[model samples]
Target: MLRKVALGSGVIALIPTISAATPVQESSKEPLKPPLMRLSELPIYEAPHAEYGEYIKSKAKAEKNSYLRSVIHPQVQAVREIAEIGIAHTESLLHTVQDNYHELRDRTEWIVQYLREEDNKEIRYGAVAMGGLTGFIFGLRGGIIRRVFYAGIGTMAMGGICFPEETKEIAKRNGALAKQYINIAYNFLYGVKPGDPQLEVKFPELSLPKNVSELTQLTINHWRVKNRSIASEKCEVECFEDLLFITILC
Candidate 1:
């Protein structure tokens, strides 16, 4: 009984020691929390002028956009349409001008060709008539002096008729000759010294027959040669003359 009472006393001593160790372990495991601050201790933030400025700018931009849509858009559209119309008109006008230019060029070419052909025909007719008339005039004359004068006249007429372009040059030369003669007369009559240079009369160089008989023979031979050449070539417009003859008969 005395030994059992001693064991009970020892168990009571271990309970206090376990209670002290539990408190020390609980303190070591838990962390300490920071103290809470009051609303008055918080940081004060000031509003920036830049944010207000940006708000004002955005509001103004919206108003400007609305005004432009209402007032300026229609006018811009009208101007754009007018510009397109003007461009179209200008392009059409350019096309018309180009077409007219081409047409004018074609007409001018045709007219020039027609005039040249008519001029050639007239020259040919004039040549034939002059040659015939000169031959006839020479045949009528009798004396040597008279015959020589007629021949000279006939030769001059024939040469001028044969080449109309040369005749224009001859006319210019004749005018110069007359001016020279007048200067000479002035020098003699009024005692004025001639200042102009002397210009000689330039005649057309031709392979003409010497006499009237030879001239007539040459004309006949020329016609025969021309007829032979025409006969040798393919007759492109021979029927035109016949048609004209038929029309005249009708």
Candidate 2:
């Protein structure tokens, strides 16, 4: 009875200790975020040129006729030129990107040489069969034909080797991408139908720029809000002059 009681007491004590212990909790982990796109990787706005032109024309039309003739017209003309230059700059930038991605310089001439070589191999084989058969049939009479055929085939066969399809495909894709970038830039800089098709003549009153930076500044100025306080003040004075005169007299 004593031993059983002692063992029961020990078991009760052990149960209490086990029940008092804390449970282990797991720490929550945060999800990783997606990488942000670089400026070069971002897609440009569509029909930016058309939108820009419309914005300009709308502003111009809202102005008084004298202001439109004296200021807005020349400003529009200058902005157009600047925007066109900016488009050209964008094209060059895009071309550089494409070249870097494609490594065009490394593959261009080499791939052409390789393709020529593959073509030459086919030509050489064909020439051999044609020449052999012709010589066997007409003996010396087929000499001229055989020589001509052989010469043509030989020239082609002389090429280095066939260019790998992978390299050629990459080059082609790069070229296409470069062209697409240029087109996108064009849409952003010049509307679908620019008012002027030709820009050979420069307008000095517009303060046309000779460099890209100047052009960019001009472009920013083109879209910026104009201060027409002078025009507004003149109209306000003309409209309220009678009221002001009566008040002054009183």
Candidate 3:
């Protein structure tokens, strides 16, 4: 009986030891985490611009509650619409300016040629007067050959002496070409083909003013006043150069 009791006690002690030593079974349902990537191998991530298109789309998707989304959606949409309209109008105006510039450039080809001819004439005259090739070379320094070439414009009402019927026809053609060129340039710059309703979003380097009034003023100053003034100045400078060249030649 004593031996049996001693053996039973030993078995009880061994049972507790075995139980403690046994490895606990891992929960099968627990998910294993993916291994972390090395710092060097980690991809560079750029956050999307808050005001840009992608952010607007993502925000719409993230909101689950219908009430909150409904309130926010209209406001977000309004902002996008405003931006689109503002950008489109600005781009259209810019394209008009570009078309006008090119048209002016096309019209001035004859004057540019005359200036070039006058420059050559001055060089030759200097050579004749100074009785040496050195004088001619030096004279050519100030009057560099300005060769400006423009492709054939369909039609233009270049100011010149012409019959009444011819003048009227030229004016009509000029208007048509002006409209055509403006559309073409605008389409190319904006990347919106004919009949396409979408307006391209542009993120210019300069941030627009937060205030609606200030933004309007800024747009007017740049697109309306400043750009037109600059274009006029350019034309004036060219005309002055042509006049100077003619005077020198004469």
Task: For each candidate, give its TM-score against the true structure.
Answer: 0.29, 0.17, 0.23
Candidate with better TM-score, 1 vs 3 = 1
Top of the candidates by lDDT: 1
**Taking the tens digit of each residue's C-alpha lDDT, what string does model 2 give over 1-250?**
9999999999987884435668788664422333455667655764444555776776677676777588778888899999999999999999999988679756876655654564576754554455455544544455776766655443333321242454347556865786667765666576555454522322234354868899998877766634366667788998799788899999
For model 2, state the Cα shift of residue 212 in Å.
Answer: 30
Error of 2 at 178 (Å): 48
Per-residue accuracy of model 3 over 1-250 as CA lDDT, tens digit each: 9999999999987874433577889887423333555767655683223224555565566765677889899999999999999999999999999999989988777544553454465643443333333334445544433111110111111222212345457767975786677767767798887778744433345554868799888988778887889999999999999999999999
Clashes of 1: 0
Instruction: Pick the winner on lDDT between candidates 1 and 3.
Output: 1
Candidate 1: stretches off by over 4 Å = 1-63, 117-250
Clashes of 2: 3
In terms of lDDT, which candidate is stronger, 1 or 2? Answer: 1
Ranking by lDDT: 1, 2, 3
